[model samples]
Target: MHRHKILVVDDEHLIRWSLEQNLKKQGYDVLVCGSGEDALRLVQDEAPDLILLDIQLPGMNGIDVLERVRDVDAEIIVIMVTALGVLETAVRAMRLGAYDYINKPFNLDELAIVIKKALESHDLKREVDQLRSTQPKKFSIDSIVCASDSLSRVLDMVRKIAGSDAGTVLIQGESGTGKELIAKAIHYESARCDRPFVAINCAAVPETLLESELMGHEKGAFTDARTQKKGLFEIADGGTVFLDEIGDMPLSIQAKLLRVLEDRVFRRVGGTRDISVDVRIVSATNKDLLAAIDEKSFRGDLYYRLQVIPLLLPPLRERRDDILPLAKQFIADFNREFGKSVHEISARAEMRLLNYDWPGNVRELRNVVERAIILESDEVLQLEHLPREMLSVAGTSPASQGLNLVLPADGIDIEDVERELIQQALDATHGNQSQAARKLNLGVDAFRYRMKKFKLL
Candidate 1:
């Protein structure tokens, strides 16, 4: 119930006094200024919520004073006051961004109405500005680099779902496929952007401890439970809870999680009463929940509940076009972080990077660029700056024969040769499936399926 502060500026003392009295009667805190200089100083120091400015000031004219005040804080509402028949001046003031204009010898009732309207508009504008400030910049969306049709479709779906209040969204993808980034984008774009976005990794925590970590525990709930604690669901009451690696969530806890999702109610581990909370759930996992359900590892009911909005993120190899763009972005970010002047990549390095399969996806590329920036002293990242494995893959030529086998002298089906090379790469990489896939320029899922098809696993 804080009163709005209003400033009254006029060379005429009588007019200033009358306006102050009227504004005070309307429950506004009024500050009176006799000259434009005093008004400008007041605006700089006090920053009143609204100003009633007279155009006929002694030293600085009202328009000039308004311009200066705008420089100080453009959002502050300014209402221009002038003598009657100064319609042209009022229009000019409006053009210069005055909130409204008032005429001298005006009706007190009309002036009060104008002030009230102006105050309301100013308050609304301030609220909108505050909300805008809370939102992440549009440029942050560019951070999600993707060019594959599947990935693009997933992004569109995420945008549409962000506008709704859907209870749960489950993102399914291979490891290093940017699932968490998509979760962040959804939360940042949704209505809950102003609230907290809490994330917990189910696989990273032990089965014995995850329940307490999620639902919290009452004092003396267990050996180390000395103090009562609020759970992640309660903490994210009005926002989102990102459950990463959800496929690995323990089955015992899954039942409680299902209850929370279905009933919007949960209880502390040893507490008696149920606590209802309003929280959006966005879960992600590299493992296939269907397979886990078939194996009696994951719950089918929870899977169905969590998949209200299912988004699948494509791996890096499937979206090759984004590789270079993502690399360049990481380079720029590393440049700023490391305070280096390296601005370009050598031709060989660029070719190697584009040709090599990035098993780690964007996260791996960022790590590679950060390593190069840290190790390289030159202005350009050269081929030598790359890891040895990447360099070896880049140097592999068709004519080279290995210890395992030799190619036919005449020729072989290029596609057959490519498949053989992929298998050899997989073998050489010691069944490090992701690394082998990268070496052979194959997508992770495709490589995995091929390995199983060929009994190479």
Candidate 2:
């Protein structure tokens, strides 16, 4: 939908006119300038995506204009227009940052191809700039949303330590508790944010390849080591390297990692000299490292080295208060993704969400909301939009298997007791109208009438 702008800079009248006509037919906004001075002015004003610059200009040469253009916007794509005799000048222009060059008395087809490639490069550069601009916002402290005080305290700690010069950080949490997100936030918030953030899963890599992955290897280190390779630590020298699932890392690799932590130097698998790097290590794990050490699967010294600052993330079940807020955030996200009009979740649906224990934690909750958004057609999300597993009687314990409660000396009212039982059945069944009715041993229609009378519908 976006129309690209092209600037044609040439002293020859016929060439400029031909280029303008052909480019206009190709759906580009064409601007023509007779000399380098006019081209510089149009660049400052129109800011064209691509420039077709003639090598021989009257006032200032095209290469001089390009040098000035670089000072203004280095990313501007410039294609030098040269004659056959001036081919050497075109190569010199390329060295000064010209994107590509086309021969004068050029084929229309060849010129079109060069213009297309330049525009594609320009678009890719814009996309990269946009991504670079948004990276800071992605890892900012305000990006994460939570409602519980437990998570609040955790995020507060993340804020305090994110900017510190800590050597090693260990994050421990169940799967789907957002440990990787916290790790990224720490890196982006630190002084090394401008550098790279490299991550590797210690459990995902095989033991044979894991050592080579953490430490570079010489060309003849192994059968597959055909060339000298830089490991993650070397590649992320001035940045943060996230070692995910570190508890599962093999003992052989752990010894090598320990050396890097202690001496800040490591040798390639078969290399003679050591390579020293200044890197901040942030490792995460779902397993108990202390238990792994006790079992002799993990080294005790490596465990202590990695846990210089330990961060424990509580599972979603312990933070019930965050359920609705996280659900709402997911709803907004899916609305944009699915192009839906759904806005609010019904209060009864909220109660069902609160009642169910999130065994899979936040990841399960996100999937549930995504599924609900796909199935929903109404403006408000209702209980029926939820998955059958969430609404089934299997998700809740039956009344006969309920908790033991002691009654006071003044016994509860009989009608009040009946109302409380109905509420519990509804909660357990996740607000399933028919299932709750069946659990209370009543007809569906009768149950609805009773629910209306008690204002529980």
TM-score of each: 0.62, 0.69
Tens digits of per-residue lDDT, candidate 2, 265-293, equal 99999899999999999999999989999
Quote the lDDT for 190 in model 2.
86
Q: Would you list the clashing residue pairs of candidate 2?
A: none
For residues 1-457, what per-residue lDDT tens digits would candidate 1 score against the true structure? 6589999998888888888888898899999998999998998888898899999888889999888888888888899999999899889889888999988887889988988888888778778887686555541345577666777888888888787888799998888888888888888888888788899999899987888888889999999999999889989889999999999898999999999989999999998999999998999999988999999999999999999888888777667667767778888888889898788876556665655667777788888889999998888987668876775533354445232222322334554445555555754676588998887678999888877765666
- Backbone clash count, each prediction separately: 0, 0
Segments in model 1 whose C-alpha atoms lie over 4 Å from true places = 1-68, 71-135, 138-140, 394-457
Residue 363 of model 1, lDDT score? 81
**CA shift at 434, candidate 1, in angstroms?**
30
Q: Where is model 2 poorest over a 10-residue stretch in terms of lDDT? A: 401-410
Worst 10 residues of 1 by lDDT: 401-410
